[model samples]
Target: MSKDQTRRRILEAAGPVFAEKGYDAATVREICSRAGVNLAAVNYYFGSKEQLYVETLQYGRDPEGQHDQPLTWPADAAPEDKLRLFIEGLVRQMLGERAPWHRQLMLREILQPTGACRQLVERHFRARMDQLLGILDEILPPEVPLSRRQQIAFSIVGQALYYRVASEIVKFLVDEDQRQAHFGVDQLAAHILDFSLAALGLHPGLAVPRPEVTHEPLEP
Candidate 1:
């Protein structure tokens, strides 16, 4: 295989392994086996298992190659539009099926951080947080304290993440037939956008369906 192809294969294989077993429990031999490459390939490319694990985390963070795309919208896009886009992106990153390890690895880090945690935060988490905070600054009044703005940004992120982190509970609480309709990523994103806008005292301009009238008597 070409040098770049080999590196990509190793990274793709390593992501799920690290996510499944974490850095300490995951083995370089297993990653090599999964990638169909010799053990020396890892050492040659990344120099160490720890370095490989960090690159895997970085790959998981941007599996869709979003970094290659324009990182932000046009300068004239409304703040609300940017906020909606941010929320939707978060929902997709957290729950999208195309790269399950992205969420799994993040959860693993949260439960038990390792040497890789610092690099992951510096490379991915902090940058994303700063972007969200910048968007929040535009939406919130200038008089609002930075601390309050940070809290609001966290609030929006927390609301979106709850659906991902507590998804099993959400599935249990939701009716089986309604699960996909209600809890799908796009649906969750819309709900979060509407809910957040409402909380901010801004209308999302999406119509809300009124409750259906029923002639059935109430249960005792």
Candidate 2:
């Protein structure tokens, strides 16, 4: 393989290992084996396991580094629209069918932060957080403190993440029929958007229609 190909292979192989085992327990030997490269390749290419771990995380989050930059919206777009798009994008990124290890690695880092956590936050998460906070600033009143706005931002993200982190619990709480009907990506996104907008006084709360019930006469 070419030099770039070798590096890419190692990264691809490393993400799932680190995500499943975490930094401390994951071995460079195993990563190299999975990549189908000699063990020396890791040391030669990455210099050390620590550096490899950091780069592995970066690769998982965004191999091209495109996500480090803020996303653009049309100049005339309404703040509510911007917020809806942001929420929908976040929900899809978490819940969409993609590499499972990507979200798993990120979630592991968040729950059990390591030395490399700072780099992940700086490179991948900072811009996204700023974007969400900017949206919240527009919808929330000026009287709302920055701290409160930050909390709101966390709340919005937490709602989306709950479906992933607590996926099993969600399945248990919501039956298959209900999940199939109301738990689709677009459905969840719209519900979250409407619920948030209503809470912020941007729109009226959603009114879910009650299901019809049939009754039999006691005599019959």
Q: In terms of lDDT, which candidate is strongest?
A: 2
TM-score list, all predictions:
0.77, 0.81
Q: Each candidate: RMSD to true structure?
A: 4.5, 4.7
Top TM-score prediction, candidate number = 2
Q: Mind giving the per-residue lDDT tens digits that candidate 2 earns over 43-91?
A: 8999989889888877867878665334578857899999988988888
- Which residue pairs of candidate 2 clash? none
The C-alpha stretches of model 2 lying farther than 4 A from their native spots are 61-70, 99-104, 206-220
Candidate 2 Cα deviation (angstroms), residue 111: 2.0
Superposed model 1: Cα runs more than 4 Å off: 1-8, 39-47, 58-71, 100-111, 204-220
Residue 4 in model 1: lDDT: 92
lDDT of 1 by residue, 1-220 (tens): 7989999999999988887787888999999999999999999999988888878888877766665332577778998899889999888877877747866787677657785657765555677888888888788889999898888888999997787678789878888889866778888898899888878878633465425535568669
Error of 1 at 105 (Å): 3.8
